[model samples]
Target: MLKRRPLAVLLGLALLSGCATLGEGGASRLDLIRQRRSLRCGVSGKIPGFSYLQTDGSYSGLDVDLCKAFAAAFVPETGAVDYRPLTAPERFTALRTGEIDLLSRNTTMNLSRDAAGGNGLSFAPVVFHDGQGLMVTTDSGINRLEDLQGQSICVGSGTTTEQNLNDAFEARGIAYTPIKYQDLNQVVAGYLQGRCQAMTSDRSQLAAARSGFADPRRHRILEEVLSKEPLAPASVGGDQRLADAMRWVVYALITAEELGITQATVQRRYNEAKRRPELTRLRRFFGIDAGLGEKLGLNDDFVVKVIRATGHYGEIYNRNLGPQSQVPIPRGLNRLGRDGGVMVAPPFQ
Candidate 1:
């Protein structure tokens, strides 16, 4: 004979299953971003000019600008954003657990991340192009990476730069000790405090950290760049809509720069472009309706807000990290395609 469950027990089981389903199908990442009222962005806690926290408890850097740009796109009038400073190890998990809407940290995009090597996530566009390098004290008598044999090197954990350092040294049969830290600040502190003889990270990061030092002239960044670091934003996997929207945001920035559209000119020229079909279409590229923003459950003006708030790609880059910034990193390979760099945007139309 079959034993029937009590009515209360049966009801409880039914309710539990329903709750499970509801939780599983609750909302998409896009919906969450909208409902949250502000985009939660993960960034480096302290990387100096790249992604450090400001005195006002806000963030300002190339990576920070990108996050703010996306948030402004989502909410134009408010331009609201929640910047979460995450260490290298915390960034990936935060994105995966939906603790953050995006990872705008100074993270390098590589095959492992792109391939989703069991982490169940991937990168967006290559927002900033960077390469790994080593920095040491000017008086260390070491001018090259090859000179660091049997020396101690400081690097961050859960970062590509550390692995690159190990691989480069091993390939050349050089011996060294890796003093791993969580982010650039600790790596810098370690080197500055003589805990390590050399500090290794992305070249732009090295420059940024050096610029923030008490005595910038005391340290020198080596000339040997080891690896190609396509620094970009990241989002968790299984959300095609969110991923596409984020990807296109980056593309739009590049496109705006390539199309010679600055924030100052976007509005003035947008009205004039209304008379020209090509210009109108180009203006629409920034999610100006036509179903792009709608597809992502965002207002049509989302991208326009991003461009207006942060300017086009070149404007943002130059303003935050280029000649105008304190660090003054040269836009070497970051130039537009016409200038022999890899930056190019697809036709907005």
Candidate 2:
């Protein structure tokens, strides 16, 4: 207090503090990923169609497919991917600490997350369009949200589901009790044990959970969608190149769907594309000439590798959430733009 610091000294101190807040300054995340030779992806292994740990010690689901796609883009032939199973509360922390290179978990993108500071995290393109919903036993006789005025609901802790449930019920002047658990399995158990009359979560998640019941037909998901949940892959912020690479990897899936490319169709398309180089977009996508992948510091044929590893967006959807899967969800808002849905990819050019 005796002497005032000069403006230059104050400014320099502020600059140093700002740099400290940003964490360690080191090599680019991309270089580290290449050196590691495998993409480490965080996922929620509880949900069936989104991300689940199989009995055979393998991860399977739509989000897992995205992880594989990312790995294929970076690692040479049959790229390597390491799946880290995380819970709702664990995913963001893992991403911020660099424990995981990417988060393919089924996380909802919202204002708070987008504006969150100090963690240096940002969401990529929306991978799945979903909404919050509720499920109850089929014989509960509670057909609507308004009917549950004094009932207990099971929900996952540290998730938007609880807040959304409170908001929706309060807006409707409905009073309810919430039993929160740390994970999906606990929530399901709480619901199944009669501690809660209903379970609330993303509609897709509810469907996935219900599918695990001894008789799935004993439960029914309510039709009312409480909140909009645009799910996407999240990566650490402050690195635009790494973010761009993750974004384009998602876009490639959409673009491949638009182009009618699939695991089965990739070989044929490659041969045809080679014969007719006039298809500029296709050519550039498959690395017939230098293109977006090169610009993103990825292999020129990254899209090809991604497609070969995980198929297109529609194929991933069908394999995980369509008729053949344990949790079959309708592709209402997830279909391609041409099919009356919101999914559309920007042109490769």
Best by lDDT: 2
- Per-residue lDDT over 113-175 for candidate 2, one digit per residue giving the tens place of the 0 to 100 score: 766464457788998989888888989998999989899999997657788988999999999
Off by over 4 Å in 2: 1-23, 116-118, 135-200, 217-224
Per-candidate total of colliding backbone pairs? 0, 0
Report the poorest 10 consecutive residues by lDDT, candidate 2.
Answer: 111-120
Candidate 1 lDDT, tens digit per residue, 186-230? 888889999898988878878887787898777777766688878
* Candidate 1 worst ten-residue window by lDDT: 18-27
Model 1 segments more than 4 A misplaced: 1-23, 134-201, 214-224, 278-280, 286-289
TM-score of decoy 1: 0.73
Error of 1 at 125 (Å): 0.3
lDDT of model 2 at position 53:
93
